[model samples]
Target: MFTNLLAFHSIFRWLVLAALFATCILFVYKHFTNKILSLKDYRFLQVVCLILNIQFILGVLLFSKSQLALLFWDNFQETVKLRQPRFFGLEHPSMMILGILLFNCFTFKIRNKINTKEAFTYFSKRFILILIIILSSIPWSFSPLTHRPNYRSLELTNF
Candidate 1:
């Protein structure tokens, strides 16, 4: 069950990224073209926010059930000394939560503003910032600080 959850979480990251990217592009196009914010645009934003919320829940479940997290708690000092454990135990989760908070803040701000142009401008900036945070927090293949599942095998391989 844990392995399945992990695999689902890993693959879902791509969907989050894709949705965010699409929303950002759409916002940019609409802003530049002087298009008014429509219901579709708002729906897109809501979907992206919903996806992030789901990812957060999955991450919390993984964190609680993970053996690595248990190890980190057992050996707090030593775990903090290592890159991979530190990233998983602290960095990744913290950054992801922070990104979600930022997204929520900007999303509410966008929703409240009556001016369409201003809302789009705010969304563009917020989306770009959130994307940066998400990208940085992700455990990319080349990242020495963290580890991720192997895409080819779809197995929960160790870092």
Candidate 2:
């Protein structure tokens, strides 16, 4: 069950990433075009929230299984003492959560109002925030993200 869950988590990452990317683009375009918030906007936001929630659950399961909870302790050197464990246990989860939080902020802020200008201003800024989250969550060895998957497969792999 654990292995199956892990594989599901791995496979789901691609969908989450793609949805985020598309939503980011849509937000950016809406910002410039001053488009009205439509049902599609709500749907996109819902998808993002749903995926983040799933990832959070999967992460919790992974953490519960091993020493992951220990590595996330507030100490830096203690956390990075190892490689794979540190990346999977700490960096990836933390950054992903931060991204989710930022995305939520956008959704929460925009859901109440109907003013086109305000929506554009608010969501555009939120879109930028989401972009920042996406940028940070990317596991670029060149950047702060050190735990990114190198390749994506349609089917989950054991290796």
Candidate 3:
């Protein structure tokens, strides 16, 4: 189950990135065009929220089941000394939660009856921040701090 969740987490990351990228692009276009956000735009934001929520849940589960997290809990000083364990156990989770919280700026952007320009400015800035946070912390295969495969198959490779 733990392995499966990890693989799923890896796979779902692509979906999360794609959704966020597309949403950010739309927000940027709207900002430059000075167009009032439409119902479709709002719905797309809702979808992005849904995707983020799902990814966050999966990440939480993986974090709970992770050996690195357990090790981090058991020996905070020791774990903090290493890079991979530290990345997976602490840096990744905290940064992701912060990014998710930053994503909630859109919630306010859509909910309040603020000026459309203000809304666009607020949301676009926070969304870009969220993107940067997530992109930075992600364990891409090329990352110098830590690295993981670009993809993980959800098959029972061990069994």
Candidate 4:
């Protein structure tokens, strides 16, 4: 079950990333090109918020069950001193929660139906900010510190 959660979390990241990029970059082509926000633009943002919300929930569950997190909690000071432990235990989760907050905040504003042009302007910038936060926090395989695979198999990382 833990391995299943790990795999799901790993695979789900792609969906989250793609949705983020589409909403912040691709779908907002109108805003970038000096056009107004279409109805679909609103939907795109909504979709990303939903995806991120679910992802955040999954992350919370995974974190609660993760051995690394347990070790970090039991050995706070020592674990924090190490790069990989610190990245996984503190940095990544915090940044991801921050991203979720930013995402929900923007979604709230849009759902309230503010001026279309102003909302588009706001969303484009806000979306980009959250995207950057999430992108930076992701532990890519190539990262020197706290790297993980593009996909997780049955075995979870011990580090």
Which has the greatest lDDT? Answer: 3
Q: Write the per-residue lDDT of candidate 4 for residues 67-134, one digit (tens) a residue.
A: 88888878998898878767767888999999999988878777655436677766777777887899
Q: Which tens-of-lDDT digit does each residue in 35-62 have in candidate 2?
A: 7777667767878888878877887786
lDDT of 3 by residue, 1-159 (tens): 888899999999999999988987897788788887666677778788889889999999999999988898789988899997888888999999888876765664565634455667667777777889999989999988799999988878765
Q: Specify the poorest-scoring 10-residue window by lDDT in model 4.
A: 111-120
Clashes of each: 0, 0, 0, 0
TM-score, cand. 2: 0.72
Give candidate 3 misplaced runs (Cα > 4 Å).
Answer: 156-159
Give the 10-residue window scoring lowest on summed lDDT in candidate 3: 108-117
Which has the higher TM-score value, candidate number 1 or candidate number 3?
3
Clashing pairs in 1: none
When summed lDDT is taken over every stretch of 10 residues in candidate 1, the lowest stretch is 150-159
Report the lDDT tens digits of candidate 1 across residue range 15-105. Answer: 8888887887887688778987776777778888899999999999999988877788789988889787778888889999999989877
- Stretches of candidate 1 above 4 Å error? 150-159
lDDT of 3 at 140: 95
